[model samples]
Target: MRFIIDVLLTGLAVFLAALVLPDSAVSVAGFGWAIVAGLIISFVNATIGTILRFFTFPLNLLTLGLISFIITVLMVQLTSYFMGSKFDVANFWWAAVFALVVALIQMLLDSLFKSKNRD
Candidate 1:
């Protein structure tokens, strides 16, 4: 149940990203694929993103977390590649926008859920 909710949230994040970033595109096939894409994206972020963040921690600190934005761009690019033709984005800037929007939404959702779970 939690996993399902997480996936749905991820999909919502992606949908929001698509709205914010002109370069990003998702299939209109419906919310189901969005959820699947979200699951894949979450997995990629968990595994690959963790490793990247660990290795780039020094740079991240040096840049005062600005490097995180670049990392997010990379993640978006990687996601675009993984989704192939179904999901597309124009450029790194578009990825950056997507990352920014998604991060904001995800942070909000996390905060909401965390507070509830604590209760």
Candidate 2:
């Protein structure tokens, strides 16, 4: 299904982020763990993130939508916490940076998938 593909792409994006960021910023011990963290991240973003974003809509508007990045960073931190040793982020700032990269990758992948679906 499309959801499964999305999760796998998210995992690839996480692996890419781990490779791009400095070792201290983010690290995934293995591909399987990356996939697990990715699935959790996707689920959290779809569920908890939706509620948080809805409640913070005013703040997000005030910040010209930049608050969404903060929300995403928190989601990534949550994923790291839930994943335990499998996924690690040194701190909030590092997690923020990693989240930005992951978001960019996810956006690109989403667009690609959408285009493929349309075709």
Candidate 3:
């Protein structure tokens, strides 16, 4: 159940990223690849993202939350590279916007599901 939910969330994130990033494109091969890529991305974010965040904590603090945007952009680019996809983000700013949109969509979906599950 949890695994399925995770995959769905990942698909949603990918879809959101694709929608926001003009250069980001997902092939119709199947959602399976998307789910797999999403899992890999999640793992990378959980591990590497933690370390990067820790190291950049000071800079993040100084920037007053702006650094997180940069972090998300990096993660997206890394994910694209890992998947060997042609998801060309225009720049960091576009990546940041994509990340923000993806986050918002994921959050909304998670919240909706969680609320229903609690009922």
Model 2 Cα RMSD, 1 decimal: 2.0
TM-score of 1: 0.78
The 0-to-1 C-alpha lDDT of every candidate, in the order given, reads 0.71, 0.87, 0.68
**Model 2 bad stretches (over 4 Å):** 108-115
User: How many steric overlaps are in each model, in order?
Assistant: 0, 0, 0
Worst lDDT 10-window in candidate 1: 21-30
Lowest summed lDDT window (length 10), candidate 2: 110-119
Candidate 2 lDDT at 48 equals 92
What C-alpha lDDT, on a 0 to 100 scale, does residue 22 get in candidate 3? 58
Model 2: how far residue 11 lies from native, Å: 0.5
Question: 1-119 in candidate 2: lDDT tens per residue?
Answer: 76678778889899989999998779999888888988888789889999999999999999998888788889999999988778999899999889889889889877777754553
Per-residue lDDT of 37 in model 1: 64
Off by over 4 Å in 1: 23-29, 108-115
